[model samples]
Target: VDIEVVQETGSTNADLMSRLPLLQRPVLRVAVHQTAGRGRAGRPWLTVPGGMLTFSLAWHLPQAPQNLLGLPLAIGVALAECLNTLNQNVQLKWPNDILRDGKKLAGILLESAAASEGGTWIVAGIGLNLQVSDELEAQVGRALADAPWLAQMDRNLLLAQLLNALASALQQFAGHGFSAFLPRWNALHAYANQSVHILDHGQILHAGIALGVDLLGCLVLQTEQGQVNVLAGDVSLRPA
Candidate 1:
């Protein structure tokens, strides 16, 4: 894998996607300071220099895009499991958000670009908070991952460990698909088996018990209508 670390960047994911056309080997681009980082629904990811760890990894895949629909969930499983090895209480929210002790600690965004006449390339961007401030805490309207070591851990060591685990997990995912990670994801799910509500905008679309995820990485909700498979998009899940 090729590694490039920048002092600053607009968004590593954007950069990787732009370079995807010419991409040959796997590459990992890390930004020490990300000026323009955004998560799902275009929400800005706030961070300060050395306060957060931001990076993006790009790789070519022989599989078609549709067949990798559950890629994000698999990535989340990789991240949560890595963190769990270092510190306990690492749980995953559906799709791909890392929650530490029920609070958001890190966010992941996965994007794929297809080269003309070739296979697809995917970039997985990650934002992990290293140090939290009262100001940063105030800016977060929702859950934020909080832990004592997050503010004191060694960034380099953390980055190395995470990158290795991610690369290995991605390789396994390419062979086994999301089915292999489903059991692991369910084991670390923060809301598994809990009553929850799936919300789009402010409206509740479905209310049911969270039964973990299916092989395709769709959230399995046991609703009144039946077992409903929920896709991740503009929708949000919350405890009911």
Candidate 2:
């Protein structure tokens, strides 16, 4: 595991993706601040220096899975598992959001590219709000959430734990796919078995009862018409 910490960067995901061709092994890149952070659907992710955990890990996969769609959900499960050990009781919003008490505590972004020689390289980026300042809350126009224990824990220690958990989870996923993690992920799903609204591009797509996720990690929604498997895309889910 190669690790690099920089004072600032545009986006750790972008940086790692750009270097994947030359990377001989997995690399973890952490930045003190990200000037241009990104989120799902090209949304901007804002961060304050020293107040958030922003990092990316680049790993090479010898053979890409047939369905790479579940990778982000797998990563979310890894994060929840790590945070649960710290007694945070974190929950996962479908696909990749991490929540604490139903509020956003962290987010994940995954990007992959074909390797120069062979195989595929994936970059997984995570942004966790350790402490939400008043200014940040105001900028976001809402109260954001953080892991309370982060104030007492050393950043490096927390990072180490997260990486360890992630490595283990990734290994399992590579070997067995997302099936092994389905049950655990559903147990931690924030909207499991609840009536929820699914939106795509700001328009209502479906209102249905959450039936957890399928083997492929797609959200299975029991709608009036039928059961719909919702894939992660330009979509959002909220309580109905």
Top-lDDT candidate index: 2
Q: What is the C-alpha local distance difference test score of each model?
A: 0.86, 0.89
lDDT of 1 at 105: 88
Q: Tell me which residue pairs clash in candidate 1.
A: 104-145
Tens-place lDDT per residue, model 2, 1-240, is 888999999999989977878899889999988988899877888877778889999999999987788889999998898898897669999878999888889999999999887888999999999878888888877778876587579989999999999999999999989988899899999998899999888789999999999988789999999999998778989889
Please write out the lDDT profile of model 1 over residues 163-198, one tens digit for every residue: 888888888888878888889999999999999999
Off by over 4 Å in 1: none
- Report the poorest 10 consecutive residues by lDDT, candidate 1: 142-151
| TM values, all candidates | 0.94, 0.96
